[model samples]
Target: MKAEGLKIILSGPSGSGKGTIVRELIKKEHFILSVSATTRLPRQGEQDGVHYFFKTKEEFETMIKDDELLEYAQFCDNYYGTPKTFIEESVKNGKDVILEIEVQGALQVKAIYPEALFVFVMPPTLTELENRLVGRNTETPAVIAQRLARAKEEVAFYKEYDYVVINDSLEEAICDIETIVAAEKLRSSRFKQEIEKVWNA
Candidate 1:
C-alpha cells in the first residue's frame, strides 16, 4: 500500500531564512508548496492563483465564515490564510504539502491536524538574526528593532515544535530538513499497514 504524504508546517521568525528553505524543499520531487489566499492587492507581476489567491475583504470574510481556511490571520488590515481544500487534495494525491506560515497560524494548523509534522527554523544566535534583518536594507532602523523584539518572542515557541533546524548554513539547513522528512516517513505508525501485509504474506 502506498503511504499518504505528510502535511508539514514550517515556521520561523522574520529573518530565519525559512522562506529560502521552503523554496529549496519544493524543488524536490513529490513536495508541493501550499499557496496562501489574501485580501492584499497583488503587487506588480504577481498573478492571481499563482502568487496568491487574491480576494476582496468581503470574499475573504465569506471564506472565514464558511471555514474554508485551515488557518487565517489579519495583517496590515488584510487577511492571509491557507485554503484547506488545496492542502487536503495535495496530500491525498501523495504530495507532501509544505505550509510556510507564522508561528500563530502554524499552531492553529497543529490544532486542526495534530498528525502533521511541525518544524521551527532558527538562526544560530539572536545577534545573527538581527544582522540578517538589517542585511535586507528594506526596513528602517526602527522597523529592524521591532523585528528583533518579535524574534525574541517567536524564538521562545521553538519548544512547541517537533523539531528545530538552525539556519546558520543554507545548504546544511536544507539537508537537515530533508533528513527529517526521510525519517518521519519511516515512523512505525505510518507503515503499520505495510508491516501487517508483510507479516500476513
Candidate 2:
C-alpha cells in the first residue's frame, strides 16, 4: 500500500505571511494546496474548482448537513469550507494536503482529525505586524487597529497548535516549517510499517 500523505492545518494572524510561505513551499511539488469551497460569488479571474469550489447557499447547507466538509464557517454572509473528498483523494495519492485557514476553522479540524499536523505562524512582534498592516495601505487606521486587536486574541489560541514558527525572515520561516514537515513524516507512528520491514528483513 502506498503511504498516505500528511494532512497539514496551518493558521496565522493577518499580515503573518503564511500565504507567502505556502506559495513558496508548493514550489517543491510534493505539497498540494487544498482548494476551498465557498458560497460567495466568483470574483474576476477566479475559476470554479481552481480558486474555489463555488456553491449556492443551499448546496453549502447540504454539505454541512451531510458532513461532506471537513470544516466550514460563514463570513460576511458567505460560507466557506474545505471539501473532505479532495483532501482524502490527494493524501491517498501521496500528496501532502495543506489547509490554510483561520484559527477557529483550524481548531474545528483538530477536533476531528487529531492526527493532522497543526502549525501556527506568528509575526516577529506585534509592532512589526502593525507596521506590515500599515505598509499594505489597504485599510483605514481604524481597521488596522481592529486587526491588531484581533491578532492578539488569535495569538492566545496558538498554544493549541503542535508547532509555532515566527515569521522574522521569510526564508527562515519556510525552512522551519519544512523541517517540521520532515520531522512529522519521520514520526514513529508514521514509520510503523517500515519498522516491521526492517525487523522482518
Candidate 3:
C-alpha cells in the first residue's frame, strides 16, 4: 500500500490571509484543498461541491448527529463544517489534504484528529491585520473594529497550533508553508510501512 498522506489544517483570524496562502500552496500538485459544507444559501457564482457542499439545515443537522463532520461551527445562525469521509479517503490514497478553517473549527478538528498538522497563519502584527480589514473597504468602521477585536481574541489561540507562519510577505509565507508540508511528508512515521518493507526485503 502507498503511504498515507498528511492531513493539514491551516487556520487564522479574519484578515490573516489564509485564503491567499492556500490558493498559492495548492498551485503545487501534491496538495488537495478540502471543500467544506455549509447550511447557508450559495451566493452569486458559487457552485455546489466546487465552492461548498450546500446543505439544507436539516441535512446538515443530520450529518452532525451522525458524526459525519470532522469539525463544525455555527456562525451568525448558519452552520459550516468540514466533511470527514472524503478527506480521510484522499489521505489514504496518498494525497495531502488541506483544510482552511477558523480558530474554533480548527480546535474542534484538532480534538478529533490529534495527528493532523496544525498551522496558524498570523499577520505581521495586529495593526497590520486591522489595516488589511480596513483596506478591504467592504465593511463599516464599526464592523472593522469588531473584526479587529475578534482577531485579537483569535491570536490567543495561535500558540496551540504546531506551526505559526507570519504573513508579512506573501511569497515568504507561501514558501514557509510549502517547506512545512515538504518536511512533514518526509517525517519517519509517514513511511513506516515502506521502511519495514525495505528491511524485510
Candidate 4:
C-alpha cells in the first residue's frame, strides 16, 4: 500500500480546550504528537524534548537564521518553534503529525503546506473562554486577561481552517475529532489506490 500521513494543526485561544483535546486525540489515535521547541524554561514536571526542547536564546536565534524551523515566533519573552526535520520524517514514515501552534504560525504553515489539515477549536464565547483560563491556576490573573484579549484576535481567523470543531465537552469534542479522522481516511485521494488494488486483485 502507498501510505500517506497528514499534518494536522490545532489552534485556539488560551484555555479554549485545545490542550485537553490534543491529549485525548493522542491517547486514542496513532498520530505522532510533535513537541515544540522553546527558549523558555521548562515548567514543573516537564521533560526536555517531551514537553518542549528548552534551548538557549542563541541557539533559537541560530535556528531562525538557518531557516531550520517550520514556523517560529516570539511568545511572551521566549522564542518557540516547530523543527523542520522531525515533521518531514514523521510524514515520510506514514505517521500523522499533530502540531498545536498559534494562529500566526498556523497561517504560515498553511501557506507552506496547503495539504496540511487545519482545524480550529473554538470556545463558545469570550466570557466562557476567560472563565476557562482563570480556572487554570498556572497563570496570573493579569496574564489570563492578556491572553483572553489576544484570543479574540486569534479566534477571528477560525474561518481559514478546513474544519471547525467546538470544544464544548471534552468527550464530545473527541468524538468529533474521531469523525474527522475517519472521514479523512476515507477521502478518495487518501485510499483510492488501495481500493483499486483490491478490485484488481
Give me the candidate number with maximum TM-score.
2
Residue range 76-117, candidate 4, lDDT tens digits: 999988888778888888777899888988898998888888
Which stretches in model 4 have alpha-carbon errors above 4 Å? 37-66, 73-80, 137-142, 191-201
Please state the error at residue 126 of candidate 2 in Å.
Answer: 1.2
Instruction: Give candidate 1's error at residue 201 in angstroms.
Output: 7.1
Weakest ten-residue segment in model 4 by summed lDDT: 23-32
lDDT (0 to 1) per candidate: 0.92, 0.92, 0.89, 0.84
Tens digits of per-residue lDDT, candidate 3, 1-201, equal 355788999998888999998898888887889988999999999999888999999999999999999877899999998899879988988888999878887888888999999999989988899899989989999999998889889889988899999999999999998888788887888888888989999
lDDT of 2 at 122: 91
Better of 3 and 4 by TM-score: 3
C-alpha TM-score for every candidate: 0.86, 0.87, 0.85, 0.76
Q: How close is candidate 2 to the true structure, as a TM-score?
A: 0.87
Off by over 4 Å in 2: 39-45, 56-59, 74-78, 197-201
Off by over 4 Å in 3: 38-48, 54-62, 73-79
How far off is residue 144 in model 4, in Å?
A: 3.8
As for candidate 2, its clashing pairs are: none
Q: After superposition, how far is residue 132 of candidate 3 from its true place, in Å?
A: 1.6
**Root mean square deviation (Cα) for candidate 3:** 2.6
Candidate 2 per-residue C-alpha lDDT over 1-201 given as tens digits, one digit per residue, 9 for 90 to 100 = 345788999999999999999999888878989989999999999999889999999999999999999877889999998899999898888888999988998888889899999999999899999999999999999999999999999999999999999999999999998899888877788878877998988
